[model samples]
Target: MKKQITSVSLGQNAKMAAALYVVISLPIVLVLAAILAISGQAGQALVVLVATPVVYAGVAALGTLIGGWLYNVVAARVGGFEFTTAEVKAG
Candidate 1:
């Protein structure tokens, strides 16, 4: 069976996904900063540490919102999206 996605809750979904992305990416950003510092790029590291999370969150949120909107438009024209799911039996 195929399921079609007609619409999405843009604001809510964007915010939630962006928050999760920020949370997951923050640590990776910190590690990158640490690596830069260790490589004698302390100035760059400081900038990255201070700016990455904020920039990343903002961009992620905006991108998600825009993407969702575009998807809705394209889907409407193309009969929406289709996906198939399978059921599994637990042992």
Candidate 2:
């Protein structure tokens, strides 16, 4: 099958990207927090664990929003990317 992504929903993309970013960062943050706490900086660890997600989510959302908007604009001018897909049969 052939497909084209003519446009994207910026709000939806941003939300999904933000959530994915937060989920991806959680484990790294957890490990960093544990290391900081083990190094006798529980306060810093707590701050890192709390603050990192907010920052990551904001950055991810903003970036994705901008990218999606740009894609739509460019796609309008130059047409959207086309690709082919095929379904795999269950063996």
What TM-scores do the predictions have? Answer: 0.71, 0.90
Model 2: per-residue Cα lDDT over 5-36, one tens digit each: 88999999999999999999999999999999
- Per-residue lDDT of model 1, residues 38-85, tens digit only: 999999998988788778788888998999999889888887778998
Q: Cα lDDT of all candidates, in order?
A: 0.87, 0.96
Q: Please give the lDDT score at residue 45 for candidate 2.
A: 100
Against the hidden true structure, what lDDT does model 1 obtain?
Answer: 0.87
Clashes of each: 0, 0
lDDT of 1 at 85: 83
Q: Which stretches of candidate 1 lie over 4 Å from their true place?
A: 35-47
Every model's Cα RMSD, please? 2.7, 1.4
Q: List candidate 2 segments past 4 Å from native.
A: 87-91
